[model samples]
Target chain A: MDPAKLLDILGNENRRKIIQLLANRPCYVSEISSRLGVGPKAIISHLGLLEQAGLIECSVDEQRRKYFNIANNMRLEVSVSPYSYTVTLHDVTFDRGKNEEDPVEKEIPPGEESSTLFLKLSSRLKELKKRQEELAQMQQQLQVEYTEAMDHCLDSIEEIARNPVECELLFELLKNETTLATLCYNLRLHPSIVNANLIGLTKRGFIEYGIKNNQYYWKIRETGVENE
Target chain B: MDPAKLLDILGNENRRKIIQLLANRPCYVSEISSRLGVGPKAIISHLGLLEQAGLIECSVDEQRRKYFNIANNMRLEVSVSPYSYTVTLHDVTFDRGKNEEDPVEKEIPPGEESSTLFLKLSSRLKELKKRQEELAQMQQQLQVEYTEAMDHCLDSIEEIARNPVECELLFELLKNETTLATLCYNLRLHPSIVNANLIGLTKRGFIEYGIKNNQYYWKIRETGVENE
Candidate 1:
């Protein structure tokens, strides 16, 4: 699913609350509307959008009441940093079909203690939460390091670039190697100007160019500056 | 900052593109407008909102032109699963002031090789990206496990609950301990109904209650079901 579209769908307060309420268990329209203090009509509209997005699904009970519950188990991550903006979505699944030995897939024997099962699940959840926290901290540390590296790279580029256009070109190249056409589009520069700058930077040994698939691409050289 | 509020601010396509452009380098209004193919008036409006949200900042360059760049480094994560929905925002920082030995803060002497610095920064970034991917995979695994645990808990509750009210009560209590007032609010049930169900579940030894600060709170018992 597109991240931007998901963001737009979840931007509303009522929609987010509805999803939160449904996360616990399935509920009919009146139950959600009454609990959230929203009118049933508005709640129905929100549920319709959520259902279309495949985030929630509806089922009919024996009494002919329709209940809504979470449909997909997924995660959406948006990372905005000085050097990057990324959105990632993960579809989480516990494939009981693939793993026959999975404890959750095993049927609970009649008369077995429910409390024992609850304790086991709760404790396992707690352990996973702790480990997730640790991983988050590590990711933060890496983010810090990344910011520092980009800052240094920018500083170095500023010192070497002879003009603003060259500086901008270097910064753009830092993201990834790109063809001249893409660079012209991204930088909004005329082909001639972009071509001149690319050739100049290449000659100065700050960057290099190569042909792949019969198209020329430019990237910053990995090695230090070469003085011929 | 509120995650939902942030989501709203970034939901616009133009605003996101503006931020993506600024991520590379600081750009003045016209530069951003022309590059993004958005009119200056609309870009300015988007900029105003982004600036208000503390995501971007403006500065006057030597030519007295207003330039905009990313004001903060942050990560926003939203997780939606069968049992939970959460939004988290993290402020990423590189505290050079506290770390004197940091290489990024050191001044590069005049005529120092820019290529060497670029190589170092690029390699470090590549390494961090790899590690971040590894961490992401681990987190996905945890999410899968969490879904399984909640599914098991729900199945067990369904089997043990005497009625739908009791089952719903168990599901609500699984989220956290709360007072009767709060449970009534969340469950949107009449006070008498919630109170009677709580009492019934407690009598069955499925849950327990305690008073703190003159308010009673109910929670699922940690041990297995009790046979009196």
Candidate 2:
């Protein structure tokens, strides 16, 4: 329900374009789809998010032609100066001076509410700036950690596979269960070579063997090592 | 950068919590990390995103302790109701009637600026509401289309791999490229069964074998089917 969430909904480029398209008038899904050159399915998802954010609303006619339009009674104002930036949104009706019964005690217009809120906000600007700095550092650290996490997985896989042949074998073992004869046949390698890779794979705990109908077959190990 | 980008930067719960913590006073990263019970690394990443959004700022003290504080001269306010929601931001100095040089002319306070903006906003509410309805219908259509697309893919995959085992094999191959022996070993199935699955897999063009250094290795086909 926070207005900040609206920004998240609009953060997407497609959503913003959708807003611009609907800014002046309402539009149907197919119309927007054709205009944007995107699949109707994707446009629907974006529109759903927008509606949830209260930026847009929808209706369906008897023919099942869905129409979309922007929400009403909402105001968004963003002003930025050299030293500071401010974003304020108001959907509540402000009847500050509308009650004229007390002319003797003139009521300041509802804009007074904003200035009061703004005063509180301005006072906290120093604090917000500090949070901004922390956020910047956090983003950098996340990118590094994300890369490290990915590299760690890849490195473990590479370690298990060791060589291209072993890698290919592990990759294949990852998919299907087969016997030594079948592996050798499909791999176009000697049974001895296939046996060597099989032994290595078994040692890595990546795979195990079983006998069915008096014939041996190999399959992925049941343990968590398969993920690696 | 667009201000909407800020929403994405602050969309994370951690970042929002960080903002609330920093709203009152400055604090070091370690302090925030310990309070939030998040690792320093994660906190650092969150701080980075907040900083990028310009919601907070930081400085390193002589003790090398980075102190974070909120930015100054900024205000963000959001209001929401069942029928509508509004977001307004102001970051500029309000000059009501600062200059006394001009006689006989009283400058309306800066709150007047908001009133004017609100009037403009009110006028556009009708247009926005229409857009909202259109957006809602678009979203519904999109959901149907998305489900339809997903169903189509599932139907195709099912048609190709009728058995559950074959389906599992296809799913795994979709992720990795492996050999017959390894596939048999990992899947814990008989080699003959693996060979049958391999035959089916090759037919579907999901995989292909190539000879490298006298050894045949299986790899995913280069075609876009790899994603499926």
Candidate 3:
């Protein structure tokens, strides 16, 4: 199973329980539905997700199909020690059914798969950036001017910067590991307006960024941004 | 915010990220959208869920109405001592808007609020049990029973005599820390099946229960439920 897909699937609480059910031993779908106390449809919904993640496999017996088995190549390791502990998080990927012939091995190192995935990821990112640039150039050639609500939202921000709810969310986004774009989108404002806020913060030296492919890694600074 | 509602809202990955975003300070919709690379519309959808959960609130500022803030009152108390430590696990609760005529004077015990909540919860359970029983009796009177699928979902002592998850959940319920309903709901199953599972396990002498309203205190036997 693609470790990335598995991670996304297991990221769900219901799917986690389904995986736990199969972890003990393989049982038929009906048995799982009974034990889990969920409708067959619900169980199947989660089961399909889990199966796609490569956490479990199924066997067909006559007309009745039973699911019983963990993926041999599945990598979910939890090592506990006094000082250091390791949890090799996995996610589902596109290439899943390829290595069914050779038994999958587990436990090499925590960052090994990530490094491998990153190598491919960087190349993909480059291709994506190139395509985005092409799109931008095409739009430019078409003399297309973007209509972003930057000025509209900036007017709103300046007027109600002290609004309790807005302030609270601003503070929260910085504290947690979330991106600025997430905050803006959640607020249903234009990306340009969000970019304006980022720019304001950048000028105030409260948020820093490094741009790559028209994307910025907005990092929080020690001093609060001078919205005022 | 209702901690339970917040929990449910944060329970999803996308929603959780939105909440995590607000952990720092207030921001607007556009910031959230661009940073996450998600469409502003999608982030708005998630924000709507968070708002309904009361984990978030929105504000209209001029032309650009920005969503910001969380409704929470609980604070975390982390106390560390030599060899032993106390950690206060509190979730924010909503309070009525009232005048504070007097200066803050008293210091209350940390667990006092939890105690009051529990007291209210017990009475609430009593009401629910009375209603559930009335419904159960009515169904019986009507000679109507749940489908075979539901009956099969009932906990089977024979099948899960040594199941680890059931044992852990039962132990917690018996300790007054939670209820079977909570366990079933969290596990994404019907509550009735949870009860049946408890009943089956209890009959096998693997667990013991003393019912108070609908809640039944269930615990493992002398040897205790085996982990493996």
Choose the strongest candidate by TM-score. 1
Candidates 1 and 2 compared: the better one by TM-score is 1
The CAPRI quality class of candidate 2 comes to: incorrect
**On a 0 to 100 scale, what is the lDDT of residue B175 in model 2?**
31
Residues A81-104, candidate 3: write the lDDT tens digits: 111112233221223333233232
**Interface C-alpha RMSD after superposing true interface residues, each candidate, one decimal:** 2.7, 29.1, 27.0
lDDT of 2 by residue, A1-228 (tens): 355665465456687667766653467998789878999999999999879777678988888888998654343333222211333444433332343444622343343233232223222332433453443334333323322322232333454466776755654453356888877765568988888988887875666799999989886565443222
> What is candidate 3's CA lDDT for residue A28?
80
Residue runs of model 2 more than 4 Å from their true location after superposition: A52-54, A61-63, A76-89, A92-228, B52-54, B75-228
Candidate 1 C-alpha lDDT tens digits along B112-199:
5666676567666667788978888888888887777777777778777888888889888876778998888776789999889888
Over all chains combined, what TM-score does candidate 3 have?
0.34
* CAPRI verdict (incorrect, acceptable, medium, high) for model 1: medium
Most DockQ-accurate candidate: 1
What are the runs in model 3 whose C-alpha is more than 4 Å off? Answer: A1-26, A33-45, A52-65, A69-228, B1-17, B33-42, B60-65, B73-90, B94-218, B222-228
| TM-score, per-candidate, Cα-based | 0.85, 0.35, 0.34
Residue A182, candidate 3: alpha-carbon lDDT: 66
- Model 1 is docked with a DockQ of 0.53
- Candidate 2, fnat value? 0.02
- Name the lDDT value of residue A113 in candidate 3: 42
